[model samples]
Target: MMTTMIRVVLPAHLRTLARVESEVRLDVPLDAEGRLTQRAILDALEARYPMLRGTIRDHVTQQRRSFLRFFACAEDLSLEPPDAPLPDAVASGAEPFFVVGAIAGG
Candidate 1:
């Protein structure tokens, strides 16, 4: 299996939980078609940082947390399919995948 080095930027709380001072670097394996996706990245992330298991997504359902959003190349990927290919910039390590904490107000 081929692996790619992916950059993932976590929210402040998650960064603290993972004990990471800055963005995380994960070696993510590509699928059979040599495609990189969000699931692959998150899988590798959780594998390396076990403490973040349920913080980013639901452990059982594997769904993203309601307060979290995904962004890459200035695009919102939160509504995209997990298996969808990320932008080339993100895949090439030119940009970081951002896991941002959303804010809501009354």
Candidate 2:
């Protein structure tokens, strides 16, 4: 069965590191009931953007790496877990998923 598509936007440094110019799009891995989860979305995103390998998660711990953020529907998802469910708009392809590198300074 076909599923909806989600657009993932990456930060500039990540884009340069990944050597990708356009936004990354993925198919929501839907279940029998058509429910889509963040884990599924992230898995697909990582698979498609191999250069983004450790940019979001720690290569050793598999934990969320520092300086990365996830956003959708104007909500900041920097601290959200990998398995957290996203908004319906994002899951249903009405909105795009964002993975941005956090800025730091003092």
Candidate 3:
């Protein structure tokens, strides 16, 4: 069976840190069925982009890092559960999964 693929865009720093040239590609399971979560996707992403092992979440605790954020459809999903269903564009493979860094300085 062939699963749909999704394009995920990482922060510039992460991309450079991960040493990836282009966006990351993820394989959506056949039965995902609108369950656009970040955990599985993140896992798959890390598996593919080994250099990004601990960019989003911690390697040991698996908890989201300090300033990492997940966004889609112009909404912030950093607080959303990793297994939560993301926007249709993301699930449908139209948009890209974004892992951005949060900056808090005035």
Quick one: best TM-score, which candidate? 1
**Would you list the C-alpha lDDT of every candidate in the order shown?**
0.91, 0.76, 0.78
Give the per-residue lDDT digits (tens) of candidate 3, residues 1-106: 3456888888888778877767877796534464656777887788877888876899999999987888877898888876777777887788888888777662
lDDT of 1: 0.91
- Where is model 3 more than 4 Å wrong at Cα? 30-34
Q: Give the C-alpha miss distance for residue 72 in model 2, angstroms.
A: 0.5
| Stretches > 4 Å off in candidate 1 | none
> What's the best-to-worst order under TM-score?
1, 3, 2
Give lDDT for model 3.
0.78
TM-score of model number 2:
0.81
- Give the winner by TM-score: 1 or 3: 1
Displacement of the residue 99 alpha carbon in candidate 3, Å: 0.7
Q: Estimate each model's TM-score.
A: 0.95, 0.81, 0.83
Pairs in clash, predicted candidate 1: none
Per-residue lDDT tens digits of candidate 2, residues 1-106? 6477887888888778877786777886765567666667767877877877777888778777777777889999767776666788887778888887668872
Which has the higher lDDT value, candidate number 2 or candidate number 3? 3
